[model samples]
Target: MNGSSALTLAGVLVLLTVVAVVIRPRGASTVDFYLAGQRVGVATNAWAICGDYFSAASFLGVAAAVYATGLDGAWYAVGFAAGFVPVLLFVAAPLRRFGEFSIPDFLGRRLGSEKVRLVAVGVVQVVILSYLVPQAVGSGITWELLVGSGLLGLSPYATGILVSTAVVAGLVAFGGMRGTTWTQAVQFLLLLGALVWLAATVVGEGFHYGDAVADLSRAPLENPAPDGGLTSEQNALHPEEPAIFGQPGARYGGLGQFALIVTLALGTAGLPHVMNRYFTSPTGAAARTTTVWVLCLAGIFYSLAVMLGTAAREIVPTAVDDHPWLADLTVDGVLQVPEHALPVLGRIYGGDAGLGVVAAGALIAVMSTIAGLLLAAAASWGHDVYERHINPRATQRQAVLAGRVTTLVTACAAAGLGLALRPETFATATASIVATMVTWAFAIAGSALTPVFLLTIWWRRTTAAAAVAGMATGMLVAVAMFTAGLFAAGGLLREALVTPTLVAAPLAAAVTVLVSLRTTAPADVEKSWLIMHGTAADRHAERLAQLVLDENRRRRAGRRARRARG
Candidate 1:
């Protein structure tokens, strides 16, 4: 890494640490630590939500995917943004209305069963840990490329993972939801700004977006594998073999394409960290509006990302002859590591300053997302498990302390796993290792939590027993299929099993419905539905009633003082 780039990257991290210190939550209440005192506004929360959702995968992998494959690569962004539609339609409002500390907390209370909460907690941890490892790994990869050296007697990769994990985890532990929210909001703006700056530079430097896509589409899409030579099934499926900028069959086959889309779309409705952010909204309506804003922001961010990828494809072949680093990583004029597509573009178009901005955005992407994941981890294991089960009578201070401890422990575990990986895996493919780990978390969350969550909120007949049974069935089946798929040879069966939500989700929903039919409903099932479906006006009324009760207590206290004076 160049001195200018290292200084820029280090400045951003220092600024974030200052932000964390400034906004860190105070007091020992769980409310302050866990949900930011439930006062986050729609715009602020929306940005934070974007920061949480757009991990290293979105910032790097999407563009890389597009750079390598003509039209098929854009699916990553499309499927990811599509997920919020389900969140807005089915989950955002209801989930906020039915809110607790986290997903598991909501489930446990809604079903009137601790067992259901425990099951949800386990599933959520699996999702969080799976997601956290990649963010950590991505941090290491970014550090190696942008900073080029390690500190504290460690390898660059190890230093990257440990430092990022420690800093973000400490932010969460100290500032909790409040500190992370503001930091994430800022991080997201930085990310969007980086994309916009790079886009403007590339376009201004004589790259026409439409012409680039049009020209690339006319030829058969080549695989951007490190070793090369994978056939384009997309071209074979259609005899004309016309170049299209937005067609299927680059990395995934026809069915594989649909499966990936469905999994990603449905998966958003169940992600632990994403939904946990909703709980920090001031009202259910705030959460709903936040989703709308997220859609807009994501649409803008991802469209730019795809365009950048297109620019890289058009610009890199010639630029490689000029930059020695580019030539070393390229195989036959195509980059061996697709993720380098953007950084190379930055150096080619905007020089060292541009490279620094893109590199900082990557680190921000990893750290900001990790903040939300660690917070969610604390909510599940610390608030939901340690406080609820182990110390039911624990004080508020004790509860918050538990959350802090969990944050540190979870961060360490994920960082250690990240240090074990080879950074090359994250840099090369369209379906890079970082992206794949995120997909596994998504697939598992979709199978185990989404069906039961939707049913609990919208279906009146969803019993606690049914929720538990359905969750168990989903998790077991997903794992079994995932294991089998790993062992199977590459083909349609492998593709379907590797990303198995299309099948697993339906099976989970079926099991939930069948079990619900045979079981007795909770005594307050109707009341739960009312809470889940309550309007904004109803929530206003509830808050107004609480205000009246507080006023009444003040008047009574005033009268008691008068009597004492007499």
Candidate 2:
């Protein structure tokens, strides 16, 4: 990009960083560092949740999926948005009420078992690492494409990976959750703004989304089919598919594929980084309200992304000879990189500067997500591991320091993994696989933890043993399925094995109920239930409102007194 463009992007990023760092609450307490002192308002918390949730996967992968697979690509957005519904109904309020630092902390406390906590921590770490690496990789890919900068003979990909990793690590280490939360919330707004602007511009340029879809539907899709060249049979199955859009059924088929979608949608409630955001809110009600906001924002963003992807398919000819970038990268005029479609659209509308903006946005999306992930990892390691396990008597300052160190270490590890994996696949493909892998994490969390959490808050008879057994079984099944799918060849068996949440989640819930029925309930279960589900949160909300009013009244009174004295 040009100097002015680079400066513009840098100026925006620096301004955001300043706001995040300066506005962070002054305190080094563990609660402040990890949960923003649990004082984040509903609207800010909602935006931060959106920032955490809308990773590189959502920003790039959704559009790329549509660009590559036609209408079928829209399923990613559908599944993603649908996942929040279950979360709102089942997980949100209860989790906030549970009041824990991390998922493992919540599980450990709820079940009253240190062993359960340790096991949950291990699983949560694995999930975070699995999810984190690909985001780092995405950051690298975006930088490489946008800046075309190669340092020390390194490719743009390597440069991107290093820069993003360092930046995110620094942000987390210095600002912690207080800074991270505000930064993420602002980042979410920027992402939404960018998408809205791009969408409007594209529409203004006469790119009709509905007409584009109709036109794409009427053409033949020429894609890389499993058995080589697109056969007549494949075309017959996807008659309405356009040449730019891949053939239907070429991706996957039957119940197994549907299971993937279900797993992803249902599994979202369980993600540690995502679930942890709820804890930042002051009360259960605020968490619930935040989720409602997230649902609305996500729905709008994903819908626009889907439309943009469809627009790319309609506007950009499949044949590379027709476009400038395609000739440089494609063989025989066919585009190979699916991820480039969105950037290409930006270039077509806003030229080089627009392309840089979208690319920078992609980078910001990754960085914001990585920052959240790192914080969650820090909480898991610092609070759950070091403080709880190694040094029970450690001071709050000690815990915060440990979290900062862990954030640095985790970011470095993720960067190494990103570099190692950068050449293996395209950014879009890697993002999907990472997202899919985390599906098991979500499933286990939703199935095992969500039920126990809900019942703990609402029902009085949820035994500790039931909670322990449920989380254990859920984790075991998800791990087994994930491992089996990794080794298994591409087929029906693989699809079934790969996306285990569809099968494992239900099984986990069943075991939890059955085990609870067999075991004697904890004596404190009723007390805990009341604490979790009672009106304390409502009372807290009323108190906060009264405090705001009182403050405002005092300010006005002070002004009157000063005037009278003068």
Highest-scoring model, lDDT: 1
lDDT of 1: 0.82
TM-score of each: 0.91, 0.86
Q: Rate the local accuracy (lDDT) of all candidates.
A: 0.82, 0.74
Q: Give the runs in model 1 whose Cα sits over 4 Å from its true position.
A: 20-25, 223-247, 423-430, 536-566
Which 10 consecutive residues of model 2 have the lowest summed lDDT? 230-239
Residue-level lDDT for 504 in candidate 1: 89
Alpha-carbon shift of residue 141 in model 2 (angstroms): 1.4
Tens digits of per-residue lDDT for model 1 on 219-334?
Answer: 66654444564434344235356434455656677776788778788888889999999999977888999999999999998898899988988788778777777766676667
For candidate 2, list the clashing residue pairs, or say none: 219-242, 220-242, 220-243, 221-242, 320-333
Q: How does candidate 1 fare on TM-score?
A: 0.91
Best by TM-score: 1
